[model samples]
Target: MWVEVLGWIIVIVLFAVGMAGTIYPILPGAVAIYAAFFVYGFMISFSPFGWVFWTLQTLIVALLFIADHAVNAWGVKRFGGSKASIVGSTIGLIIGPFVIPAFGLIIGPFAGAVLGELYARSSLEQSLKVGFGSLVGLFTSVVAKIVLQLLMIVLFIIWLLV
Candidate 1:
């Protein structure tokens, strides 16, 4: 009984962190959620997580990786950004939190896109437009990830119960 209680606590906390990770790139949110599932099933009984379920989970992880990059790249391209802009945005994303914790995530991509476009000899106005696109893409990704993570958690709960 005590072991089960402790497991629940760990799983809950990890899930919460995973949800937060969807918005904050600093955390491995999706993986954390997947870990929670693994921990729960392992500590209790792997009977619940069959091979089919594990396969789907693995595919979801892959999808997350593909989506993250695709959305960002699409955003840059749709807004007339070049490869340099994408690279810059990626760099900014990695560096943002470290440089400015409060708003680095928001500012990093925008600034990076702008700088990247400028480097490519784009006009200031064009650079700014690309920055806005980056911002849109960032927010869209965050929302999409949040929904996906929630759905994953709900699915796990269903699997556990049923």
Candidate 2:
């Protein structure tokens, strides 16, 4: 009983951290949440859900993980970003957490977009727009992840209670 409570606490903490990480680039936000669910499910003996549920959940997680990267690349593509831009934006995202505080996450992607657009079109204004668009795309994904996390939590609760 105590172990189960401890596990729950750990999972909850990870979930919260993942929530913040979803915005920031340093942390593997959705991955952390996905891991938490997998842990919780297995720890609870996979009681309510059968093999099918676990398999489907795992597949969904894999797709979301891939989507995280693909969506950003798509954002850059939409703005006519070059190969360098895509690569640079990825680097910027990595550097973002260290360079800036709260705003770094938001700024890094835009900076990357700017770098990408500049390389592709040689236009500062257009690059800025592309960067902004990428930021919007990232924000949208984060919101979606939050919604999914909430739904997952509710499902877990329902499974446990009923």
Candidate 3:
């Protein structure tokens, strides 16, 4: 009984963190939730988490990765940004957090997109539009991840209970 209680606690905490990771990239997001479900299944009985569960979870994870990049690139392109803008946005996303704390995440992508567009010889106004598009993509990605993450958690819980 005690072990089961502890397991529940662990699962809940991980789920919370995992969901948080949707927007706060450092947390773990989909992977964390997937891991949590696995751990819980192991602790209880892997029999409940059969191939179907695995397949669905795996697919969702794959989609998460694909959507993350695709959406971002789409945002850039939608705003008339070039390949450079996409590349720059990616670079900024990687380096922004290290250079600036709270705001770096937002600034990095925007600046990167703008700089990338500028490099491509786009006008300043166009560059700004690309930067804004990058931000839209970021937010959209976050929302999508959050929904998918939630779906994963709910699926696990349903399976566990059923």
Candidate 4:
């Protein structure tokens, strides 16, 4: 009993941490949520809906992670950014974790696109356009992930309540 209770607490904490990870580049938010669900389901012995559900959830999370990165790159490319801008965006994303809280998340991607464009072609106007495109793509990706998280939460709640 105590172990189950402990599991619940740990899972909740991990879920929050994972969500935060989604914002920061270093952590995997969806994975955290999936892990929490996985653990809780195991503790309760909720039958087939338990582990199988979470395994599928984990797969979706993984797909979203990949899709997000790809879309962001595509967005930059759509605006004529070269390989340099893409590389810069990646660097900016990595650097974002260390700087100003949530702001870094936005700035990092934008800076990366701009820097990438500047390096690739030395054109300020084109760089700005690429940055803007990248920003839009990033925003869309965030929305999609958030929606996915919400769906997972809803499914968990429904299963638990029903």
Which structure among the candidates has the greatest lDDT? 3
lDDT of each residue in 39-145, candidate 3, tens digit only: 78766668888889999999999999899889989999999999999999989877887799889789999999999999999999999999999999988898899
- Runs with alpha carbons beyond 4 Å of true place in candidate 1: none
Order of quality (lDDT): 3, 1, 4, 2
Query: Which runs in model 3 stand beyond 4 Å of their true positions?
Result: none
lDDT of 2 by residue, 24-112 (tens): 76776767776777667666556677665556566656766777777777777776676777776777777876898877777787898
Descending-TM-score candidate ranking: 1, 3, 4, 2
**What's the lDDT for candidate 1?**
0.85
TM-score per candidate, chains pooled: 0.95, 0.84, 0.93, 0.84
Backbone clashes, candidate 3:
0
Q: Give the Cα lDDT of each candidate.
A: 0.85, 0.72, 0.89, 0.77
Taking all chains together, the TM-score of candidate 4 against the true structure is 0.84
Residue pairs whose backbone atoms clash in candidate 3: none
Displacement of residue 77 (Cα, Å) in model 3 is 0.7
Off by over 4 Å in 4: 46-55
Give candidate 2's error at residue 73 in angstroms.
1.9
